[model samples]
Target: MDLDQSTTVESTQSGSSSSGYCRTNSEISGFSEHLTDDFNSCSSETSSPVSWPVTGRSPFRPTLSRFGAIRHDHKLEKDDKLNDQKPTDLELEMMKERFSKLLLGEDMSGSGKGVSTAVTVSNAITNLYVSVFGQHQRLEPLYSDKKRMWKREMTCLLSVCNYIVEFVPASQNLQNKPSMEMMISRLRSDIDINLPALIKLDALLIEILDSFQETEFWYDEQGSMSRNSLSGSFRGAPQPQRKEDKWWLPLPCVPAGGLSETTKKHLRQKRDSANQIHKAAMAINSSILSDMTIPHSYISSLPKSGRTSVGDTIYRSMISTSRFSAEYLLDCLDISSEHEALELADRIEASMYTWRQKACSNYPKSSWEIVKEKMEGDKNVVLAERAEILLFSLKQRFPELAQTTLDTSKIQYNKDVGQAILESYSRVLEGLAYNIVGWIEDVLFVEKSMTNQQES
Candidate 1:
């Protein structure tokens, strides 16, 4: 029952120190000698006394030895000698009986010797050999043309199973932590040492023993049979089917519109921060477009001067939120001038998603450029409409950026630019009361006109 522990136990010999646990050949030989000695002692004590022939006891009956002790001692010596010699029919029969008893965890005391024991032991030995060795074909000689031995062998096997079920868990020292080799060795030893006594076990009990080592059952701690106990036999056999393997626990998702208050708060804060950053970037982008188009006199009309050139400051701001890091932009400029703008655009596009991790939405400065690219490639009006809808979504999600588009007025707006800005502006003010609606309506109407000359 204790599936995890080793069954073979190493004991300290009569003469050796117990500190180290190593078994030398000499120690084994000594142990064998000791077993032999015990057998001799028992046999001598149990042997019938040599008696006087005529007077029945006139000449002192040489002290009668106990017959039982003699039988026990003779069995042991027979077993020890049998290990060296080819097992006799009688010895083999004895072995099978003892094997069964050991497996049943029954006391193997008085079973007599016969051919049946030899056959059973032979088969059990063969089975053990098969259990350890690579191939079954090599052991065909033993089982060939041998039927009675096979029957006896079956009993031995059943008994072995029963023995294991009872023996494994009950042996506390082995149960603690047994090695595989030790278990196998003990199994071999039990068959070797207890053969004669296992001859008498019942057939039904033997079958119960055989099922303990079946392959299909998973013997975890919580399984039907405990490694520590064998109070009951296996009620049923394992099913043949295999179950599918899985890596993760399965669970359902949270419902829509069921956001927690803390989640909503976090989302709002994130949206606000992204909007602020996006607004600063767009302000610079708008300025860059203005600087590219507007005259110096038109620029001078707008704002007060400082140490940083307005154009350079605006360029830096636009480039900062654009996508590529400051270091990358500087490197690209230093490396190449021909595709500087396109390179910058690509970098911005590539880096847009990186910032959206904190924002939950991709409200990068390069988003407008992305929209422009999509618009240029678009053939269907519905596609353009969808793009516009997405743009409106961005404006609603990020109000600060929408406000920036309205406040920065250095560049006169085209029809397309005016419509986009007005849409953003309307979304930003929609939740405000009637008074603010009028103000927003007026801002929508107020657009900077682009003349035919400027367009040309």
Candidate 2:
């Protein structure tokens, strides 16, 4: 009768062959006990209820149906498909058009509906420069000869500068208001003081561009004169073209031989004037760009606290006015860790899943659970936004649950959320900067290439 004690079991009403195998009653009892214990352990794990951390009640557990899980998997597959597709030509064209409008002072929205007329003119001027100088073929002839081509290119550049200067007055008088007129008048007055300087700078730039001169003598093959005859001796053989000299060599002005003393003195005076003017122009432009600030309207529209998309607008404006300011803004935004931010975002998404599961089990019948379940059904809700809404709802319903959820998730996830937001803002700023800089550099490089075409 004792289950723990060993006892032999005898077969009843059986043949000798069937009675051959026998087992102890104690061993059989022990095997049955072991099986029962294993069953109990498995049942406890699978069927036992999860306890709420704060409250002792056994809340209703919300289980995801097989169909719902399958739907989620399908959504993930669709997202992967979308991500795998490359951007089409149409998309690239649209992006370029929007960026062009941004450089022309349109807002980041790229609506281009209400831009100012001055901005339109500015865009036209920029487009003209791009169309003319952007072509390599158009500039190839300008740089064919190192010694002579620079003068022609410099002359062409002076004309271009003159065109810009003429447009400056029009650009300043854009608004046509009395105050703007006064401002234009003051700008003209200042230009008058610098007019001499500007003119000298122009002449000096041309001289600098054409400064390289390699002496050459042409031998007159038709001359039938003896070499010993001083009067008709064949001129020294024409000096070979010094193709090795660069076109943009900024050589100092050298007095030409066989010129009068008066002409040489005047040339020396002009050379000094050109140098002084060049220095003055560089200093003035540098000072003007360095002191520039974001417009009042731009700054006023920015958010007083957290990050905003308006920063892109500010960045574009800065780029149009000053490269230094644009670079400074990029530095301030600190966009280099964008990859890290994205990785952290993915980690936060994973952590949020774990938090949601635990929080859902704790507050199964609460209003927060209702919101979460409703949001779960909405495929459009992003993970970060959904997490924010859930947290808000939980705080409203039960503060204890919200605090416990935060404690469980820890601070790393929250820090990543903040960093991700900053990174998003920085990316926008970076994109705007790149587009604007590219446009400006394209125009500038054309001018530079014309002067230094040999290197090109």
Show the colliding residue pairs in model 2: 217-238, 217-239
> Which regions of candidate 2 are displaced past 4 Å?
1-115, 124-187, 194-196, 213-279, 287-293, 301-456
List, residue by residue over 132-153, the lDDT tens digit for candidate 2: 2222111011122221222222
Clashes of each: 24, 2
Off by over 4 Å in 1: 1-297, 300-407, 410-456
Best by lDDT: 2
CA-lDDT, candidates in order: 0.26, 0.27
What tens-digit string does per-residue lDDT give for candidate 1 at 174-238?
56576333221122233222222222111111121221222211222113333342333222322
Error of 2 at 21 (Å): 99
